[model samples]
Target: MKDAAFNQLTHARRYFEAKSAVYDENARGWYGRLTDALLSQALDLSVFSRLPDGFRFLDVGGGAGRWTERIATANPESSGVLLDVSPGMVRHAERRATRCGYAHRVRHINGDVDEAGELLAGMTFDLIINTHHLLGFFHSPDLVLGSIVPLLTDHGLMVSVLPSRWHAAFGDLSVGDAERARRSLSGLSWEAHEAPYGHLFTPGEVRMLHTSSKLTVDLLTGFPCLIYPDPPGVASPSAESAEDFLRDDTFFREVLAMETELLIDPDAGARGANLFVVASRVQPAEA
Candidate 1:
């Protein structure tokens, strides 16, 4: 690896290690709830029912194994392997698996995705998930995709959640950092002080990346489309009120329902805070 990339990777590892204990706390916030809800819609558990028993899944860059646990619990016959860069996060993931009583079915690896090919050699998954902006962590999306795509079974599926370029630009604009916003829109990787540098992509760019890798884009959409670009720190109505609403399961369900409808809007990819994509190995041409 090059010196700059290695340094960046080291920086990200240290950051996640320090934040490991509190990393799952993000799921407690309204934003986190909405994000997960959106991702769940894309997941559509019904698809998993079609796979044979003891199907395998891999969660790339899955921290603390939250999503892995959810999938494993839902599909009792399924097993999972969670690969992450932070040992602290990997430790927490192991504990989560044990506490959840499915440790036997789940494995944790402490390593970076850049080394995923070597680390997970000879292992292929029926389903591969790259969630929580995993693509943002690397300098090259192709490098990440190339290493991971080959680890999929012939008919396997890969679901990816990518941080939106437009969302980052809007976030910078909301913070009155016009320069940063411009850079974001220009597609340059940038980092906040003490934060890991990340790459953000438009939906089109995402499609291009996968298709170039010989994977067919199956589904591409955005979540929380109706409530995004709401300016930094401000919730839909008010912070306190949003917090109250977030606590109300009924209210959250209603909001998610409305957002789901809006997610199919042709422009949702550009308007949403993040992009969700499902892809698979390109099908061979029939004679």
Candidate 2:
């Protein structure tokens, strides 16, 4: 017998919630800046060219609703649903939503993501975001991509950031060390948590989705994806693929927003923590 995946996630969430107070007191707030920057980049409203005044979005497995809160705040045009398998995290997300004052603008669901349909039944959204590769939540990512992809409005887009073990950038942590960390997580979800760099993805990996998934890869960027260059640790249950401590200045942010992938997308350069990919659920253009 073994611990269930949901149980494991619950444990992780509980651990973070327990430490949340300490993090608030002494954690340097490093995690907060890194997470905010990473999510803001992925949901780039700039790329949309003509973002609507109001839209609906979903944050799958969004713990504490951190990213959702930020995205909704920046784009008041957006309202959302925050779904997580952990009831504890869902509570945090609700509290965050309320503080962000998007409480009336969002819905919160507590259940297994494998049972997402019951939560998503009869609904559609303009954008679906899974910051930090929420892909790890499912035993079958194909199911996640299949069931949820259809929930998007025809022109809607789905953006996912996953951990890729085969990445161009490995940070200060050597591949061997990363592999060890992965193997330490036990079986099953080790894939979601440590191994495969927690479902960290490489280029073209998204092609493995179900045929009905209907999402076409639009753009992918691997950025400060990790804070390792800055070499510290990751926020528990919060996944923002970022590398070291790049200064938070606009110039550096712009450079990171621009240059991270130029080095890694096709090959490797200095190395990055995580990669960001944007996909659109649309039919191919006619010839």
lDDT of 1 by residue, 72-181 (tens): 99788899799999998899889889988899998899998778889988999999997867777666777677778999999888888887888888778766789988
Best-matching candidate per TM-score: 1
What's the lDDT of the predicted structure labeled candidate 1? Answer: 0.78
Of candidate 1, the 10-residue stretch with the lowest lDDT total is 1-10
Local accuracy by lDDT, each model: 0.78, 0.58
Model 2, span 31-89: residue lDDT tens? 44554565465455323443456878888867677778877787776788988766767
Error of 1 at 109 (Å): 0.9
- Which whole-number lDDT from 0 to 100 does residue 217 have in model 1? 83
- Model 2 ranges with Cα > 4 A deviation: 1-32, 45-51, 167-198, 210-212, 225-227, 230-271, 284-287
What ranges in model 1 sit over 4 Å off? 1-7, 24-27, 45-50, 190-195, 229-245, 248-250, 263-266
